[model samples]
Target: MPETPKKLTIATRASRLALWQAEHVRDRLQELYPLCEVGLLTMTTRGDQILDRSLSKVGGKGLFVKELETALLDGRADLAVHSLKDVPVDLHSPFALSVVLERDDPRDAFVSNGYGSMDELPAGAVVGTSSLRREAQIRQRHPGLVVQPLRGNLDTRLGKLDRGDYAAIILAAAGLRRLGLEARIRGYLPVEQSLPAAGQGALGIEVLEARADMHAWLAPLADPATTACALAERAVSRVLGGSCQVPLAAYAQVQGGTLAVDALVAEPDGSVIIRARAAGPVADAAALGERVAQDLLAKGARPILDRLSMPDASA
Candidate 1:
């Protein structure tokens, strides 16, 4: 371990859920080094400020992270805690994903106002979600139901659903559990039914690459199983060149010493779906993801992916 710093600061978004995750990290760090101090620096990002359009239309991977990265670069914060799903695979130089905490429920939650489950919901009902992955699966399984784009902070999204704008909404089960709103979940979407987004339910610590001391301090917080699974899952996305615009899902599970990964690519309207799976020793997780991605491409996912072009990110 490197020499512990006397004090450290964490940068985070100001949403209720983001604050909770940051505070959790602060508490754990304090518990580990009783003498050291930890504090939070909360700020709103452009992602949080813009809610009128689809995030995939506005931007995706970096909107939630770039502001926090600036804070780290300017020395305003020692590190930032994030939902690993929001972190881009092609992180710029000098920034490293230093640690990933243990994962929570890595499944999508089905929440509705009056429905007990999917079967109980009437045909042609409206369902809301911020994720392309969720939307694609919902359309595939419930073609009669109307899918609408719903985006905002957790509370904001829930409020929209409550206003009857949607018959129900889909959210990550982990967020609901963290906010003590698990009671609102009518059901858990099975992994077989809805594969999770890569890095869906894990919290990651990002720090400057040169900060060896910070890396050492954060290393102890990493959950090896979650880390391996996330790496493999992310590998699939990396290979497929996925962004929010693409309806892609990748999930990995580790058993004993082996890692298995599943990946999906689908049309934006859910008109078609393509899938691939591969497994190998845990040590070859990234390679396993690559193999799966290759399989998907060879099996006709390339045309599906090519349709979801990266718009001028600068636009």
Candidate 2:
């Protein structure tokens, strides 16, 4: 008789986008292993609850991910599926990013009711965005507009837009597409306009380090291109000591056997922007990213980052 297949339970946030990503993984796993049992352990994270203030104020990247991680640590779930951007570049022991799916559009989307694009919006127009990266980029490009802190999930943010609260808003093009809201996007900001966050538009599967037995089960789901790009982008963040509080952005693209990376660090007020770029063989993606990060730091990124707010939850 054949041995029974192992059951897999994935932990995830209750947000529509998070659910979609988890369900996607579940469906893929089912297809790969027709006899395996897959389940979802959905929970609300602290980031989802504390919506009054900026995510930076409450807790940076971990706020969105801690609970799901806890579920995995406590053995309640076999995996934690997350948006790669939300996962911290510096991970703790016993927890490892075991798999990464192919990336989606790694650009920021401009969504509005009447405006066709953010460039067309008149001066003093209010733009909603939760990310410091988007705010800084918008402020630098369109100083005439008002950048407001917009928090909450996709539906809530869209609700605010529909309610006439913001003239325009910026969001990850990937999320919009994943939710079937791609039609809501009016335009996509070019990479030069808004460098995406590290690991944006990708999915990461987190599993305990001790679960070496499961590696083969998940390895087939990994996308080499996305993994290389994500590593390069995350290397920039790691080398720069960046978190949500700091207005930092990094994007990496892989072509053939080479990887090109772009990174930026800015003051929250959007007064200063330091940017850098690098390209090298894709096999050296992490090294390429670190080189760009060092290039930017040598160009005065550290002082600006020091003056910026550090939102460490433990502190």
Candidate 3:
């Protein structure tokens, strides 16, 4: 008798962007292993159901990932597809990030119907975004613009703009491209103006650490440069013990075998901002991130960080 065919199950959130990412991974896996059957298992997360409270207040970035991870832990799924940024700084030991796909445009884009760019928006124009990092940056740069809390999936946010609820909104450029809505973006925010969230524009495939066969199968998809850069970005968050409640942002990129990392921390109200950068060999990505975080913390980021770390803040 012939041996049974192997089937791989990929778990992901049901959101359009999440499914797109899962499908991207599924196609790649199928291409590499012709005999393997790939299936997608979509699940909803706590973040998806709680639109009323800010992510930071509700439970930080982990809200979007915990449910999917649980599915993996329960043996219902072999792999979990996640937005790199949404993964927490610390992860459970049994699980490991097996592969990181090549990153997309790791910048935030300004999506607007009336304005050409953030600068062109009329004074007092309502700009929508759910990210505290973006909210703080917008406040610093365009103080005159009104920052409004907007939540829901990507399509829902854009629908609000179409319905005249907002003049503009900020969203990740990579997501817009994934959904084929890049044309709606009026301008892309440069890093100088808005440092991206840690691990932005990247996709992470996570699986059980003991699954050697699965790891070997997925290894080909891993991009070393992207992985190094993402690790460096996440390192800043980890070193600082940051969560969604803290207004923190970090982005790293590898150029000519050198990794450059930029990180920032701001007061919740956007009153104080501390920014720093570091460069080193790509192999020392995590160390470089720690160095940058230490520098920022030394430069009075500690006080601002203390306020954010208060226990009741997350509650």
Model 1 lDDT per residue over 1-315, tens place: 877679999999999999999999999999889999899999999999989888888878689999999999999999999999999987878899999999999999999998988778888899999988988888888888989989899999999989999999999999999999999999999998889999999999999999999999988899999998988888899998989988999999998898989989988778888988998899888899889999999999988777686465313
The clash number for model 3 is 0
Local accuracy of candidate 3 as per-residue lDDT tens digits, 1-315? 123228989999999999999999999988877888999999999999998878877887788888888888899999999999988879878889888899999999999988899999889899998888998999998889899888899998899999999999999999999999999988899999989999899999989898877788888899999999988998999888888888899999888989999999997567788999999999999999999999899888888777788878656
What are the candidates' C-alpha RMSDs? 1.6, 2.2, 2.2
Indicate the TM-score of model 3. Answer: 0.96
What ranking of all candidate models by lDDT puts the best one first?
1, 2, 3
lDDT of 2 by residue, 59-113 (tens): 6878888898889889999899999999999988888989889999999999999
Candidate 3 lDDT score relative to the true structure: 0.90
What is the Cα root-mean-square deviation between model 2 and the actual structure? 2.2
Question: Candidate 1 — which residues are off by over 4 angstroms?
Answer: 310-315
Q: By lDDT, is 1 or 3 better?
A: 1
Among these predicted structures, which one has the highest lDDT? 1
Q: What is the lDDT of every predicted structure here?
A: 0.91, 0.90, 0.90
| Candidate 1: RMSD to truth | 1.6
